[model samples]
Target: MKKTILLLIIISTIISCKTVKPSAENNVLVLKGTVEKMGMSTFQYGTHLLKTESKTYALKTAIVKLDDYVGKEVSITGSKVEGYPVENGPDLIDVKKIVIK
Candidate 1:
């Protein structure tokens, strides 16, 4: 039937138009921002924050303490721990290297 064929075509078109989210695994991300600590209400410890132009991301670093970078501009290279479309709060990332700017 023509109606059945049209329905199938519409379904295929809709499925093809859907967007897919990028995987964070093994994908290095470079972000520039100021390092700062999240407030007490965040319910997290040993995690800092990178305040960028558009979004603020939670920074998890084991190499260097974030206290030294606080209030200072820095460029960080790391892989994302959490993807965008964060519902509750900022996205999370694991820092690999940091350079003061």
Candidate 2:
């Protein structure tokens, strides 16, 4: 009886445990484009920019350090870091990786 109770406790503990998920705070998206322009300002993500084949997006959620990848053709995976629909500007994105392809 004691052994069964102990086994049950262990199983319950394992089943109840939760695993952490990666931060989905930023809405991740992918874009391919040239570094048409870039800038930094006192914003949420410290201000970053990219001009894609279709449109331009801004990185403005959390300060992203991507100065090393300016003026290059690349693919970026990040979240739509910031922006409002009415006042169209760049959507702040937290870049996951910059691939020169």
Candidate 3:
């Protein structure tokens, strides 16, 4: 009984750890980065930007006020808006969720 309880506890602990990893697949974009206000641009679409290690992303959202999380590292889950990245711009993501780290 004690061994079984220990095993169950170990499994539960492992499963409880949920990490938000950055990924882009099948028009779904999951990423972690620092949020910043969008600088001057010719195309006015997104309100903010997310900068990661390798790439930067233009971001927009109606779910949450992105202005609250500016200059902080965050994890984001969003969908790629159709017809973006025009003329060598970053991919535009319609953020559904934002979690500050």
Candidate 4:
């Protein structure tokens, strides 16, 4: 009876455990672009992104809370995080600083 309970507990623990998601917070990148709000719906708030001549990057961290510079051109320093594309999709960045151009 004790062995069965222990096995059940172990199984339950394993089932309850969640897989850790991988992140790209460690890869740093420097970029320059204009800030733009993004989303599909008109009523919902959209995400902020940096638009460059050749690419767009989803900006986070530094600019997530600050919105004074929207639609303005600026240079930013940040890290390349997951979900950003290296060749096609908009790059993802955790912005550290922004310099207006």
Best candidate, TM-score: 3
TM-score of 3: 0.70
Candidate 1: residue pairs that collide: none
Query: Model 4, range 27-47, lDDT digits (tens) per residue?
Result: 556787898876553222225
Residue-pair clash count for candidate 2: 7
Write candidate 1's Cα lDDT for 1-101 as tens digits. 99999999999887776534455544888899999977764435337889999988888888877788988999999887645425566777788889999
Judge candidate 2 at residue 16 and give its lDDT: 66
lDDT tens per residue, model 2, 1-101:
99999999998787666334445553568788765445544443325577777787764433434666678888887775434422444566677777787
lDDT of 4 at 34: 91
> How high is each candidate's TM-score?
0.64, 0.55, 0.70, 0.57
Which pairs clash in model 2? 45-60, 45-62, 58-90, 59-93, 60-92, 81-92, 82-92
Question: Lowest summed-lDDT stretch of 10 residues in model 2?
Answer: 81-90
Q: State each model's C-alpha RMSD to the native.
A: 8.2, 5.0, 8.9, 8.3
Misplaced by over 4 Å in model 1 are 1-26, 42-46, 82-87
Q: Which candidate model has the greater lDDT, 1 or 4?
A: 1
Model 4 regions more than 4 Å off: 1-26, 41-46, 62-64, 83-89
At residue 71, give the lDDT of candidate 1: 89
lDDT of 3 by residue, 1-101 (tens): 99999999998876665333434455676899999999898767799999999999999988989999999999999999889988678889999999998
